[model samples]
Target: MTVVAEAPTFLWLEITGRCQLACGHCYADSSPLGDHGTMSAADWRAVIDAAAELGVGMVQLIGGEPTLHPGLAGLVGHALAAGLQVEIYTNLLHVTAALWKVFTLPGVRLATSYTTRPTQPAMRRSRAGRARMPGPARTSPKRSAARYRCVSA
Candidate 1:
């Protein structure tokens, strides 16, 4: 007998591998010098189209930092236009104006992680300043419906 597997309802796309900080616990080994993979905007668009065609209801954009991708806004827009819910996992350290706009889109949401253990001395210093920085609370639109998920380690 053959077993059939159902199509995935949720998908994760690692849009980039570049980040501002290097955390020891990072499973992706993401760092300031991480390689931004060769996937182009067109390539990502095609993937988004294919996922939507496959009946994928949601796509989570993750990375060394997803916001570092230059075409992030366009990718999110394309996914939303294709009727796919978009979730972005980021460090909340380098969100640009364009990316902020994408976060306000109807079908979009944001997630971030914070680690109390500063494995790297540089990371410890950086976290000290970041701890005082207002994250999504200060940047998010007052009337935006986007949901935010915060994970701490």
Candidate 2:
């Protein structure tokens, strides 16, 4: 057999078809009742091992809803323990502060987005003008955003 080389760094996985909301600008077309398929801890362990063996530097665990995965923390911990950099995209609604507490580890990054659509005119203007406006000037301030970066191990 011939030997093959691995890329230095790359995102090897994506759970693109899952999400908690089906918004107008949703890129993945996710919904609450959307397909609930998921990979188990064992499955992720296999993928991690293979990637490690190939010398892949970064291993991203993504999904329709990666936070919804039962093995999320376990898998992240596993990858970090194996010396692979980890990153995830998520809607923070399902992420508890407790969960965030556990995920803070070395070599991990969480990228999240607060998914909110400004329905009203004033709210839209405020949000649209968020770049130039200060925090207090906006109306209908959203507390919990669906997206945020989390570093959980």
Candidate 3:
């Protein structure tokens, strides 16, 4: 008999532990003041390479908000370059024009966790989510490409 371990279907890369919001129901308790100082692009590159070697087809980029990571675009590009599907979850709080260009990349899936607490009025923090995040960029089997997914959590 022969045995082979099953490869993981997907993996998560937490690029940052900081966020622009302090949502009451946050699973990670992320805040504007949180810190994710040590990890670097090289570190992420290694992880992506490893997963690809193991036949993991997809990777989810998360954070307090992974968008807040300065090298986010490069990171996404690198992952796609490595032939891995990428998904990002963010409030879409502060997306810039340059970042918008990045979101148009072929394998990137952008999901907006546009949230509202019953106690507090809806906060207009996700400038990206509001203006540009209104439709699906496109869709494919390995990854569902959407510019917006109004997720509440």
Candidate 4:
């Protein structure tokens, strides 16, 4: 007999709506129009701490683009410290060397959408054992074919 595992309950927190790239099919309606809102760092911390106290096991950080949040690293770190497994949905366009260092924390995973160019083979190879949310990029008339490839790959 096979036992099926139950899906864990998780909080999908929206910390900001700011994004450097504005994709055409973004359901959140995020844009580079600079009209995005951000949650205060204190508020974000409070939620993480509360979730820990409530015994929540997972938290998914989302946004127009979560990395655009000024205190993204701090927020993720707080959640990790609180004993929750964290995952993020990212476009992977802005992650720099310093940014990748943020994922060194235990129980953190990234599901990046490479709508244009896929992540470096070396990076994907290293992360093979970890959970990832990967998908092709959405297409629209706004972005050139070449630019879209860059975003989706």
- Highest-scoring model, lDDT: 1
Q: Show the lowest summed lDDT stretch of 10 residues, model 1.
A: 143-152
Q: Candidate 3 clashing pairs?
A: 93-126
TM-scores for every predicted model? 0.74, 0.62, 0.72, 0.66
Model 4 spans with C-alpha error above 4 angstroms: 1-8, 34-38, 114-153
Per-model tally of clashing residue pairs: 0, 16, 1, 13
For model 3 the TM-score comes to 0.72
- What is the C-alpha lDDT profile of model 3 across 24-135, one tens digit per residue? 4455546666677697789988998999898989899888888889888988888899899988887887788998888888988887754445623333233332333223
Which candidate model has the greater TM-score, 1 or 2?
1
Residues 56-88 of candidate 2: C-alpha lDDT, one tens digit per residue: 888776666677766677888888787899887
* Candidate 4, backbone clash total: 13
Candidate 4 lDDT score relative to the true structure: 0.67
The digit string of per-residue lDDT tens for model 1 on 34-122 reads 66699889999999999999999999999888888888889999999999999999888757786788799999999886555454444
Per-residue error at 45 for model 4, in Å?
0.5
Give each prediction's root-mean-square deviation over alpha carbons. 12.6, 10.5, 13.0, 8.9
The residue pairs found clashing in candidate 1 are none
Error of 3 at 83 (Å): 0.3
